[model samples]
Target: MKINVEVDCTPEEARRAVGLPDLTPLHDKYVSMMMETMQGGVPPEMLETMMRSWAPMGEAGMAMWRKLFEGGAKS
Candidate 1:
């Protein structure tokens, strides 16, 4: 025997049902900051430095990124 259940609700409702934190505000802030940076309020080198610092696993993060792209290129 098999049982199936269907849920019909908005994404917010689904998130709430799963007990996930609502990150809409944080996402909006991140998008706003990215737009500001892209509009020349921040220099390219400064953005690169910031991204490198935010990367996981410290310096190895860059190596991992390179490998990821390299694998994509081969396919």
Candidate 2:
């Protein structure tokens, strides 16, 4: 059996249909803050911390992957 469905709608419309909360304002604020940080003096450690917080696996997962890759490379 073969079936196809096509959805043609703007992102906002799709989001609304899906009952997702509108995060446009939050996203815009985050982007604006990033821009300001890049233009101003954002410390490297602060940026690193922020990036780590956003990572789903965080430092432990990244460390495991790094070790696996290094072991494979040595083999």
Candidate 3:
């Protein structure tokens, strides 16, 4: 047997129902940092190094990123 239920709610409400933590502040900080990088207040290499350090697989993750971009460029 199967039951179907329909519920209408805003995104925030849905997120709360699923017990997801609110990420508004984190998102705001990320956007602000990206904007600073775009304005040259932060060097691209520094941002890349920071991101690479944060990746779980480090160099391997960066290699995958390079491959993805190279494939996109060829297409």
Candidate 4:
């Protein structure tokens, strides 16, 4: 037996349908903090340490984050 069902919805609607907690607020706060950090609100060593802890994928994750910040800076 095979079944095919399609439900059209926006990403947010899909997330809600799946019972995912809304993280928009948390994401916004995180972005704001990141901006502050990039603008020198936090020291380099502390930022590195924090990134090490937050980026579970280790150096690769850090590199990805580095690319993101670098791109932002270029904008």
- TM-score of each model, in listed order: 0.56, 0.61, 0.54, 0.75
lDDT digits (tens) for residues 1-75 of candidate 4: 999999999999999999999999999999998787788756668877878898979899999877876697799
Model 1 scores a TM of: 0.56
For 1-75, candidate 1 gives per-residue lDDT tens digits of 999999899999999999999999999999788666656556656756876877798779867755764584487
Q: Ten residues in a row with the worst lDDT in model 2?
A: 64-73
What's the lDDT for all of these models? 0.77, 0.76, 0.77, 0.85
TM-score leaderboard ranking: 4, 2, 1, 3
The number of clashing residue pairs in each candidate reads: 0, 0, 0, 0
At residue 66, give the lDDT of candidate 2: 52
**Cα RMSD (angstroms) for every candidate in the order listed:** 5.9, 8.3, 4.7, 2.0
Off by over 4 Å in 2: 59-75
Candidate with the larger lDDT of 2 and 4: 4
Candidate 2, 10: how far from true, in Å? 1.6
**Cα lDDT for residue 50, candidate 4:** 79
